[model samples]
Target: MKALTASSLTGLALLALTGCGESVSNRLMAPTDGPSATKAGTPIMRGLTSSAGVVPTAYDGNTSGDGSSSCSALGFGSTGTKVDGAYSQKVGGYQFTVSGSEKQYLAFAPSGTPTSTILAVIVKGGDAYDVYNYRNNPRTSDAGLTSPYNHGGNIPTISHYVVCYGPYTPPIFTKTLVGVMKEGATIGSMEDDLSWRDHPDLVIIPWGRTRWLDWQLSYTLPPGVTGIITENATTVCGSLGTFRLQCTFNENPATYPIYTWSGLSGQGAVLVMNDLGGGGAGSCGDHDYTNTATLALSNGTTLTASKTITVRVVCPTTP
Candidate 1:
């Protein structure tokens, strides 16, 4: 296979994904540094519509979700540069900042500590683009997409994404390990560090205009787990047997921790101790948890772990 270069397709002018357009591989959609393709067209934003014709702006600090009361419009040039709407404001204690003199992006975040977990946008003149929604401590490649090419893995480098026209379908922005809060650090921060890049305009077609972008911050992610086991006791030490084990962590406090079991004994045999992962606590402190492991021995003998576990396994019938 040919080596995929991030820079080659980063500026491919928003070509169509079907027919003559290049189709990306599945690897690109799963967080792999795979190859990418670009379409040849200017980026464009969509317009939202409501029964009232258009969304009206108010002098007082108030914004409406109705399409007639709020709308954003975008235009693009052949050179893939944006021509209008590059300003932002606040509503309901939330901050909206838009960027992209050429191809704009919109970023929204809470004001205080300043961290953006979700990013959305329309490519001013183009129809296709990428939106990266991240969590508090966003990690590289944690973003999602609805590009012509659905490449996953860590979020792609910003420069690699196309700001071209679209007849596009984007997925709902989900929480990643990082977010727009890091849009400003440096080129490296976008791909390495967790600094926000310039908080750009997102593509929320509020009202009848593609002019306004909305990033709701009430969403969060549940913490993930870490750790696994190799095999069970009933199986031969060197024999091929399925070992069952799992561990989890909770990132979002709102969601409680839940556990599932896997192994020869089937499901629900094992329990996820609250003491173990701390129910997704502040420090994720010491993992002093407990659980039972059962291994069915073919031979009339018992097996034990090198590290003493909470419970012992009962030997099955001797061969």
Candidate 2:
């Protein structure tokens, strides 16, 4: 098998899997430095959207369910990068100071999360909070609105929360994790993401199977950025028998964090970073970085997705 490089997301020797009857040997063509392809490429998956109910589009600043409003019904339309579950990649969340004190409003789109009615979006400013959820319909699903959240007033150090019950096993959500925006502004000051993609957009998985899943992932890992996805994950002994972070590439090919996972089916991680400036590749300032990752499944299918995460750094000063 040939090696997979992250610099070129579109080109690579594909790993073709052959199936025999009801069972098959699942495998992913692994890179030269990491584990063998057969070890990292098994085909067993997981999911986070199993239970929920009908939800209204935009609620009127109330923790409890309030009235609703649709963009079409009110002469508005929805438009943007519309994908099913694209929001799944944004597990760590984003935070950025949008404007330099300009009077604006926030329009948000929580991708791939509208289908789960059990989910809720809450915003906190000063001492009060509000709720806004996605409207899973033909007219609205890309983004949602937490509008007039400031009333053109002092936009205090605001905070946003995306939470869901039942499936969350008591909701271990990152309270301040969110992707917020205004009419014309950035989502937040710090945007962290791991945009996971599956090929054949419409391909459905065969349920109740344990041998159909193996994965090989490649990331356009940036320099001077140290965070969850960039560093080696922690796995204590005896923590076996379930899905966990298998292994990450140790900068073998340069510019990419090639990795493999036992199962990323229903996993979420907080994106905490340390821009300590010891990497020697990064300077103090807002770094607008564009990264991408390609996930190779055991079924011989590959998926690629790109993301733009802008992180600002402040260098330490000495006497």
Candidate 3:
């Protein structure tokens, strides 16, 4: 983040007062008295496909039947007891059954590619239900269910199922300020540096007033800088009101150059960075700054974006 010199400010004020056209560089280079207004755009939902075909496997919850208690207390069934081995069915080439006493189970056959990745599953019923990744680590089992019971009156039946891989690298943006005006306005266009490893699962739903998703932002300061003032603009929907999101960021003396915002959805779903730093001033420094934004779904699928920015301040000299 760069600051404008006294001379530059004087010239900018003159141009504005005289109704003269301003250059883009001048607009971006201008110092902001406060944070800038959010740029609005439609939120995107991307789809993901498995690297290879996967076959479903059967996981019986009855410890006596399988001689393994790994799923003893993990099923959500009518009797509230572990599912009987007979509770097996096939749907869309995937095997589905009850596991433990409170969880549903699905199994995927081995694939040629053995790379590690997160799997997201959705079990739809009267209301959409998201499955949980009980095994937190990257898995090859390809089978699991929601952590808690859907508890939709009757045994929650699988209305729909979808899977995708995750824990992806986020997109980064870097822009050189060449113009300015007052603070809290559009500075300039940003150059995107997209660096990611995996594809995020696509989630499509009808647009509604209720907030089906939530997010938070975090800031990282550079080394040696301290006592910096920071503020987060209240999160709100975009003007289009069609699944758009917006927020603000500010730091006095602007120490923290990097910030990240992440989101999570569904029941018992724990994303790595969810709701951090409710927005306030804090100590920061002059170091490589990184910002992260993550979105998680009810079926245990997560999407993340991380940006690292290097702050280079070039103040103008007074002539």
For this target, which candidate reaches the highest TM-score against the unseen true structure?
3
TM-score (C-alpha) between model 2 and the true structure: 0.19
Residues 184-230 of candidate 3 have per-residue lDDT tens digits of 22444332112111211111111221111122232231121111111
* Alpha-carbon runs more than 4 Å astray in model 1: 1-84, 100-103, 112-125, 129-319
Cα lDDT tens digits, model 2, 124-213, are 333333333323211112222222222212333333433321121111112121232111135433322212122211111112111111
lDDT of 1 by residue, 243-300 (tens): 2112223223444332222222212122211111111112111211122222322111
lDDT of each: 0.23, 0.26, 0.28
> Which candidate do you rate higher for TM-score, 1 or 2?
1
lDDT of 3: 0.28
lDDT of 1 at 121: 26
Q: After superposition, how far is residue 108 of candidate 2 from its true place, in Å?
A: 41
Q: Candidate 2: where is the Cα deviation over 4 Å?
A: 1-257, 263-282, 316-319
Report how far residue 202 has shifted in candidate 3, in Å: 31
